[model samples]
Target: MTSPILLTGGTGTLGRHVVPLLRDAGCEVRVLSRRAHQPVEGVQYATGDLLKGEGIESAVDGAEVVLHLAGDAKNDEVTTRNLVRVASQAGVRHVVYISVIAADRVPLGYFRAKLGAERAVSESGVPWTTLRAAQFHDLVLTVLGKMTKLPVVPAPGAVRLQPVDSREVAARLVELTLDKPAGLVPDLAGPKVYSMPDLVRSYLRVRGQRKPLVPVPMPGKVGRVYRAGGNLTLEGADLGERTWEDFLAERVR
Candidate 1:
């Protein structure tokens, strides 16, 4: 029998793609889920909870690689610290963590928590790789849906973003697991950059909504940071193939 590869967040947006990628690579995949379900072909589900540390040790046991993709958006720092401790104690050979690009540059509490999580992963004695990626197109889609309902999109002024496909990000994570652990690889971005208003307008056009776009400055220091391109990648690295337009087209129609 082959030792399994433990994947946290196996049922999440990226997890849906990563499971198939690992399977195609001929690696036995074990996913940590809150509840056990009918296992998919070439995939096993183990009951685990990020908050309670339930079923983590058993899931990590005898696994060659542990992909730590499960972190709470509300409490990312605490959840990450807990996961790191468990991974270290389990003697996992390789720990791969997914982080947000420009986490340090953004003063948003969410980004701060992610940065704290990255620090935890780096400090852990186990070999680890942290892959930072830009905001996903799906996330942007959600934002567009919400903002379109309002009379104005409340577009942050001059905020630059490079949204990547979640699948591409997941594929990179799977590739990283196959190779030796490299610490803090260059950030991944989408094929192009778009401003907040531009994205909103594009979304509106695609949806055939004629809502007047009242572009307004985002409030607070975090909004200022976002306007300063807090979410963009300045360093060139891995660029995904999918564009926001591509995602928007499929969803709009």
Candidate 2:
């Protein structure tokens, strides 16, 4: 029989996909959350808050592996440290962390937080693995949704994105959980690289919107990084199966 697994952020986009995978694999799954949630088949929920370090001990108790998926890009450092402390005390064996691509190099605040969280996991004195992935397609849609509301669409001409499906990322995380603790795995990206204009046009196409595409530069160090492809993983773009356009067409249309 396999050991029980403790998951943080089990209700998140990626976590929701992962829980069923684990359950189908016949592994007992325990979820840690901040609020009460109705029961679901093949899963158990424990109330906990990572920020204030409340209810974490019970969440980590007797769990051989801790799959950490929940994090606030703004304050994940504290949350991650709290998790590490509790999980370590509970004698958890392996900790899996999900992070963004180029988190160590990016100048963005959230990226910085991810890097700090990665360090927390690595330095926690427990066997751990970290998987850094490109932006999820859901996030891309959120950005596009905001742009569609504007009278005119401002498109970033210089930036490119390879948005992977969150489901694919979840699969990779599950695979990593079963493998021996490798420090950090290769970055994962979508099947194709798309410029900001290409993605926006596709959004407009699928949504049947004819909003004028205004070629605009995103102003800031973050924008400059994006324009320079700092957020992209060129070699990793071949990792996932789904493309941004297909994702939009299937989900958004």
The top-ranked prediction according to TM-score is 2
lDDT of 1 by residue, 108-208 (tens): 77888899989988898889999999998989898788888887557766688889999899989999988889999988889989988889889888878
- Error at 163, model 2, angstroms: 0.3
Give the lDDT of residue 68 in candidate 1.
82
Whole-model lDDT values for every prediction: 0.85, 0.89
> What overall lDDT, based on C-alpha atoms, would model 2 receive against the true structure?
0.89
- How far off is residue 126 in model 2, in Å? 0.7
Residue runs of model 1 more than 4 Å from their true location after superposition: none
lDDT (10s digit) by residue, model 2, range 98-120: 99999977797899999999999
Alpha-carbon shift of residue 180 in model 2 (angstroms)? 1.1
Candidate 1 residue 77 C-alpha distance from true site, Å? 1.8
Error of 1 at 149 (Å): 1.0
Q: Clash pairs of candidate 2?
A: none
